[model samples]
Target: MTHKILIADDEPNIVISLEYLLQREGYAVLVARDGQEALDTIAREQPALVLLDVMMPHKTGFEVCQAVRADEAL
Candidate 1:
């Protein structure tokens, strides 16, 4: 099965590059422009992995990580 990967970053270049690279390797990629969106996407998509930015709009990467860990369902 194709594993889903989430790229959570506000940088367009990084997101585009990573998406292209991961897609080329046949992995399904999802994107979030900000930390809040990242959290929402994470909950909805349940991606196998997430590439998050340390600093983002709405919330930080560390905050997102903490939320994920704190949530038992996630």
Candidate 2:
């Protein structure tokens, strides 16, 4: 099955790299800069998986993960 992966990170290089790699693997890639954007994207798309960086702006990856896990919509 085709799956979508959300990559949340502040670094543009990291985002681009992950997108390229994951896309090459035939997965749809969605990018988010910083934790808030990541959360927003997750709420909007409900991607199959996520790659979150630990030290992001607005909120940390730890916070984001906790929030995502706590989200009933997920």
Candidate 3:
């Protein structure tokens, strides 16, 4: 199966580049422009991996990681 990867960053260029590279590598990519969106996408898509930005808007990457870890269902 093709694994789904989440790219959680506010920068458009980085998102585009990463999406291109990952897609070329045969992984299904999902993008989230901010931390809150990242968290929501994570819950909905259940990506196998997340490439997260540390200083995103709404919530930091640390906060997102903590939230994921805290949630038993995730």
- The candidate that wins on lDDT is 1
Q: Which window of ten consecutive residues has the lowest lDDT sum in model 3?
A: 65-74
Those runs of model 1 whose alpha carbons end farther than 4 Å from true positions after fitting are none
What C-alpha lDDT values do all the predictions have? 0.98, 0.94, 0.96
Report RMSD (Å) for each prediction in the order shown: 0.4, 0.9, 0.6
> Using alpha carbons, what is the TM-score of model 1?
0.98
Query: Candidate 2, which ten residues in sequence have the lowest lDDT sum?
Result: 9-18
Query: How are the candidates ranked when ordered by lDDT, highest leading?
Result: 1, 3, 2
Model 1 clash pairs?
A: none
Ranking by TM-score: 1, 3, 2
Clashing pairs in 3: none
Off by over 4 Å in 3: none
Using all chains and alpha carbons, the TM-scores for the candidates as numbered come to 0.98, 0.93, 0.97
Higher TM-score: candidate 2 or 3? 3
